[model samples]
Target: MAIPRVKHFEITLTDEGVAIIAFNRPAHRNALNGEVYKEWDRSLMWAAQSPEVKVTILTGKGKLYMGGHQLASTADIDESKSRKAVKESIVCVQSLLNTLINFPKLLIAAVNGPAIGIGMTTLALCDVVYAVPDAIFLTPFMQFGFCAEGCSSYTFPSRIIPPDNFISDVVAIATKTTNFPPIAIFQTKNLVRARERETLMAVNRNECEVLLER
Candidate 1:
């Protein structure tokens, strides 16, 4: 029997004109390794240049949002290889981020579970995010023995969770074991509004429709 090839993601345009991009690797907690990153970069660039997609909703397949990068996949990689992999991952993620940020359509994360590491950092770039009540948001750069990527170093502290002594807060949270509730982070300074997952989905749908109508 031949081994089957898996698609890293699937894209579908809803009747309401929302482009749904599902990260489809539930078994590995949707770990986005190299192939997934390449596919994501290509797909987002395609979508950004296309006129058909009016909005993009990014979600993970199955229960959890994403477990972040595939740590297990790198078990055999040496330090040099690991560095190269991280660099490539950053390029791919940054490419998609820059494209999405500049794209004409709205970008939203339909976060359903723990959005860890890159999963958490990616939301820093999303225009809207619908996080589940139990959503676990973590940035384990230092913990994971890696520096921050995804332009998160610049964006996360300055904009996403701006607070009193914001730079201090940024330094305080930039570590391995720290996990912060999105709402608690929001309340610290009141720069963002994180709604219930259901409410956010509704708001996403409504906002998409409103944008389409305009």
Candidate 2:
């Protein structure tokens, strides 16, 4: 399939069904804006509907994986939110995160370099996270005087990193997993994350509430 182009990222689908979504705004350190969020939501929806995509690999361009949110995009969101607005925002992001967490196809995050903000937290949602030797992971929530988003508060302390190595450890497991029947894979994935959906949504609401109060 032809790759889709946007202001913030690139999505490439391979014949082998490995869809790679690379953040392309290296000039801004891959900082996410409203457009990126829109593209992300749409891309995930496309992937969910397309049988051609069996797995997705998310990464970034240039030296840094991602930096933080774009100021303009979040400024209005922070300034004018009512209770209903806050709830809506929370529900929207939580829905997307849940879709990613419970994605039908496999999800992999290749942290090419420093990953901060959502970049750091999103690693926890991916089925596999591969970081280069120099890759640095940081939440920067405390540094920014914010709490958490992307469910890192729950995932980070839990040592969400699976296995010791991505290739030998995770790939081997994924190979075995995919070798199984597709229905079996879906069931196993669903069972593994059965309660996590509710937990993550609750966490997202809580975090948003705290942010609103602060």
Candidate 3:
């Protein structure tokens, strides 16, 4: 299947039916912006709908996994545009969170390096996470005067695999997972996530509201 093209993310579908989505903006340490969120939503939807994609892996290019939201994008917001920008950001974030909350495929995260802010929070949404020993996970939301926006409050205490070869190891696991029967994979994930789906939706909505108020 042809994966959707994205400017901010590099997406590839392996023959094993794993869709690898990497944050490609290494020049900025893989920090996310409105554009990145939009592209992510689109890419994830494509993978979810593609029969060829049985699982999806999220990772980052270069050294850092993700630097979180691009604070620099808001640095230039003027008094007149501040409200509008904030509203737009809230919408984009809410949409992205909703996508992750409802995604049916097996989701894996390869934390190659530091995962800050949303980077850290989003790992809770993935089914599996593999991190390098030196990789840092921090959510300085209070320091930044922002609340969590990725259902981290409800999804905390997430697990992670400390692996030596992060990317290759993650891909190997994903490949093995993809070899399972497709219906079994989908139904098992659906049953496991059924109980938390509504709760996650509520958390995502509450988080976005709180973020907007902040």
Candidate 4:
């Protein structure tokens, strides 16, 4: 069946134990806005309480995973609106990440394409991550005059990447550089697998099989 827009989430069963939560927004590259956040929060809560869902695979509909908060949503915000939007945004992201972090079930991120800003940090909380080799990443908050949120401060450094991957340099840049890509700044074995974008569905299916086997 075709999935609808309106910030709705698509949950499909891949196996007995694996569920996929696809962020079904293509027009804006699945960017998270307030409405999307509300829907995502509701969807995650629903999944968390469902007995049939043993794992959740986070992904996007179109080529891009997510480009972070919708730039359009940021438009016309007064100081109060900005604060409220930012605060609510943080809460929405934190709520989803916390659910994944503490959920007994596994959380896997299928990075079909670029995942910018909170999109990148959210993956850090997942149990496993799979990325397309060509995926671009960005954390543009500092460059946009904001501080880090979504618990990335603790999660980022705690994970380790390959020595040859320049983990230290990446971390240093994220810490010092304005609006840097955290994915490039650190490496991690947490990424259990990686693949080309063309094979994303196959890789997702394979990951689901692995999760079911566990």
Provide TM-scores for the models.
0.64, 0.77, 0.93, 0.64
Clash pairs, candidate 3, are: none
Which candidate number maximizes TM-score? 3
lDDT of 3 by residue, 171-202 (tens): 98899987788889789889988999999999
Ranking by lDDT: 3, 2, 1, 4
Instruction: Report model 3's TM-score to 2 decimal places.
Output: 0.93
lDDT value for model 3: 0.86
lDDT of each: 0.59, 0.68, 0.86, 0.58
| Candidate 2 minimal-lDDT segment of 10 residues | 157-166
- Residue 13, candidate 1: C-alpha displacement in angstroms: 0.8
Lowest-scoring 10 consecutive residues by lDDT in candidate 3?
156-165
Once fitted onto the true fold, the runs of candidate 1 whose alpha carbons sit more than 4 angstroms away are 1-6, 73-75, 78-84, 156-214
Q: Candidate 4: misplaced stretches above 4 Å? A: 1-6, 73-75, 157-214
Model 4 error, position 168 (Å): 34
When summed lDDT is taken over every stretch of 10 residues in candidate 4, the lowest stretch is 189-198
Off by over 4 Å in 3: 73-75, 157-164
Per-residue CA lDDT of model 2 for 122-186, tens digit only, reads: 77877667776677787778886777888877876222333245333333434444445667757
